[model samples]
Target chain A: MEKNKKNKLSIVSLVKKYLPATVALVPLTIIPAPAYAGLITIAVSSTGALNFGSLDAGGTGGTVVISPAGARTQTGSVVLLSGAGLESAGLLSISGSTGVLIDVAMTNPAFAITGPGAPMNVGGFNIDGGGSSVSLTLPTNPATFPLGATLTVAAGQTAGVYFGTYTVMANYQ
Target chain B: MKNTKKGSDIGKALLMGTALVSLSSYQAEAATGTGLMSAIILTPIDVTSTQVLHFGSMSVTTAVGTITVVPNGTGGTRNAGTGSVTEIAGAGLESEGALQITAATGLVMNVALTAGPFTVDDPGAGLPMTVDTFMGQAVPAAFPFTTSIVGPATNVIVPVGATLNVPAGQEAAVAGITPATFTGSYTVDVNYM
Candidate 1:
């Protein structure tokens, strides 16, 4: 019994003596770099001002509609002129480096115009050149498309220059 | 007997040293770093135009003139000749193209601009004019900019200014329409390195 106890004590002492040295070797493992690497870039610009220039709602009044697909049409008694008085759909060009599908978000999905009277709602606002909310694969480096808003008019609405601001955003998937 | 005992002691020392080294290596193999791994899957860099780049209402003289606007967001003036490049007082943020960039951090990016030779046509008249020059500057005027991922936001402001070169007599020849603005847009890309 005495001999066995002595041996056990020696083994404990040996363990204590070498424990610190064992701990010192912990920092030498090799590490490698991450497997994937790349970055993406995106840009946007209004190809031209979204101008609903000089419109005559006539004496009765009418609605001027511009579609996101670059179509312009009028309802009611509105008459659009062509002699230097041009009305055009707003064009926004989206550029992306990833060449992948991206999400587009818009602030103030609706806008309004006012002139010497109560504000008029310019509803049916669209920015994706299609539906209101859509994700699209960047077709080109700088893909140019139309963003449109429809001006709703009340009968006998006042005529003057009206203005407002809206914003469009893009993000990667 | 004495020499043999000394040899045995040396052998025991060597064995203990070897055992210590082997145990230490095993402990090291089980140990892990405490510094933590930090990473971010960067979102695509996005740029939005808050303001359009415009020289603002310019009038040209019979003489060929060049309008140069500095990139400091200052309005430009026509070179001495016949035309006038008056800074439209309080013309808003039209003199320089104001834009905002949003993305992740730790990125070294390259900025490239593709511009110039943009054409604007007179409606129905068929006489189209050309804007021969356009230029831009990145904010802080540094290439390969580095940014932080942890902050209130990870975004930068890049203000770009442009110069429009009108030939000798192209101003008055433009279509006679009020607010008959000319359009010229340049493509700017932020490439990652």
Candidate 2:
């Protein structure tokens, strides 16, 4: 009977030793963690459209390229026009938590621009300053970047205004 | 036993909470934006042959000779290489081959001619004469030409010329009673450079 009483006392001592740590965990589990509030919020918007100005695709077709710096160039039989407006690269505005590294990508790298005539292909998407990835600087909620691409004009491409849509995605790295 | 069970429940709750937080964070950390792409296409380049190249009538003697037609607009000159060959001069008898190319003004283009030593055959006579050394004369420029400037007023014209080889003692058509006429063709290709 004396031995049985000793075992019960030891059990009580074991619970006392571990009970404080277990009690500490209960509040942490029930109160809800505040780390959720620290999650970064990311948003992307377009500031301007990517424009390749007037061009002539001669007997043999050619390609027109727009650089991230908003400069336009061409190859093959494509001719650049001296119209009133200047060609420009696409502009994107990204807003996110400061000091976070962000990745930039084109959901559709290659697509076609349609118009009255045949469709012209657009590809070779690029970004300036940083390629494919960028970091948000301190004190700036929204960071802006430039994007560019190449347009393929077919031989005897019908004369008209061509239009296409592209998607740019931003994610925290 | 009761304390141990309570600790286990707390651990399970912590794991579930952590999972929920991860899901919420992922949903808010990514976004997509759309941008417009645009281009304006102009008219395409066009080319056509305005005039056909013709080498005039000639008579061969006892020696081998050649006839050369110069490519100089419509009034191109024809010359006999050897003294033995005689060129029959007549109105509308011979002229240089001409091509009219049209494209955007100031656009540069390349002109190519495909003519190897080809035979000009007269069906009446079994003997055939070979024509070779084809050349092109581009106005505002010389032969072996590279670029032609497109026009605000007139399209660029390229006149072609070649040499015709006549064998010694060549036979006439229809048992030497009627004149023999020979004919063959060459290709001209033009493209924007």
Candidate 3:
């Protein structure tokens, strides 16, 4: 016929080029095959600070503790201020604030601790008798303010407690 | 020329597979950057002078005499300040507050580790006990100034250039210093110069 119509138009142009390449493989196989394949995440961040350590001659309100393994970076929080003023006139205040948390304890091998209050700063005459009361009677330590709650040291008692060693500094500014 | 050389090898394999899918999508198009700052730290309780317990302002004479203090040494450096102008030992008088000995040039100095050796009696006396509190620190207690103590190391720190040469006649020994368990305290401003 024209040669049989050129072989049926080359078999209808190879079925229209394989029917759009088999319809692009049916969207790569029914499209219901995504299986969520692109995403992953995890996060953590905590800027740091807590450098507390200083209670020399801790006689007025007496307290000292800071251990969390002595800390360098425990994830932060311990501000305690008031450092310059020891020419010897006496005006050192550390009752609270500077990153407050005045007394939080537990140490001896166990860590994470604190207790820094009572550096009350006084000295016009409360010398040892603490007569007008400035806090000094430490026997067996009921918090130690011993002058005579019947703590008994009789004889001629004048002044005692000779312990000294300060500078408990800490920081992760 | 051969179908344009087979369409330039399929456009060079689609630009190398679109750069291998954009370098494997670099961990899903990742991007992160951060920074922060603020500082000022210091914790110092360095009341340095090393060690001192000197005295000598001139009007010294209360009674239990033996005065000679000043790094002199007998026990360690010098311990020849044995004084006594008063004798009243047994204890019973607790003033949590309201105690003052203003012009007695007071040095109720009580450093007893007692079992024995402490006495203060004079001023005719009857019940003139006068404790005002000793080691816990606070003699004048608080009148027109800051006063209160009971701290770590328990104050002996008189560092300002320190020169407490309490000489004149020196007398207020009452040091029975008992510490089987007895902490310390003081507030001696015997300024009778």
Per-candidate clash tally: 2, 1, 84
Model 1 misplaced stretches (Cα beyond 4 Å): A1-37, B1-193
Task: Tell me the lDDT of model 1 at B16.
Answer: 36
Candidate 2 recovers what fraction of true contacts?
0.62
Tens digit of lDDT per residue, candidate 3, span B1-193? Answer: 1235434444343221111112222221111211111111222122223332322212225542332222212211122333442212233211121122221111122222223222223333211122221221223122123322233323332211111122222333322322111112233332111
Shift in Å, residue A95, candidate 3:
38
Candidate 2 chain B lowest-lDDT run of ten: B16-25
Point out the higher-scoring one by TM-score: 1 or 2: 2
Share of real interface contacts recovered by each model?
0.00, 0.62, 0.01
Off by over 4 Å in 3: A1-39, A47-173, B1-23, B28-193
Which of the two, 2 or 3, has more TM-score?
2
Predicted complexes: DockQ each? 0.01, 0.28, 0.03
Model 1 lDDT tens row, A1-173: 99999757765555455456554323334433222223235655566555564444544567777766545677875655333334566776777654677666554556666566556676675665665555777666778766777776665555445665556666666
lDDT of 2 by residue, A112-163 (tens): 8899998888888887645544454424778788888899988889987899
lDDT of 1 by residue, B1-193 (tens): 1236544454355333322222211111011111010011124556688667666555565456555544554432333222544434444434566667675454444555544456655465323555544544543343233332345668765666545655545545654655556664556666443
Stronger candidate by DockQ (1 vs 3): 3
How many pairs of residues collide in model 1? 2
Ranking according to DockQ, highest score first: 2, 3, 1
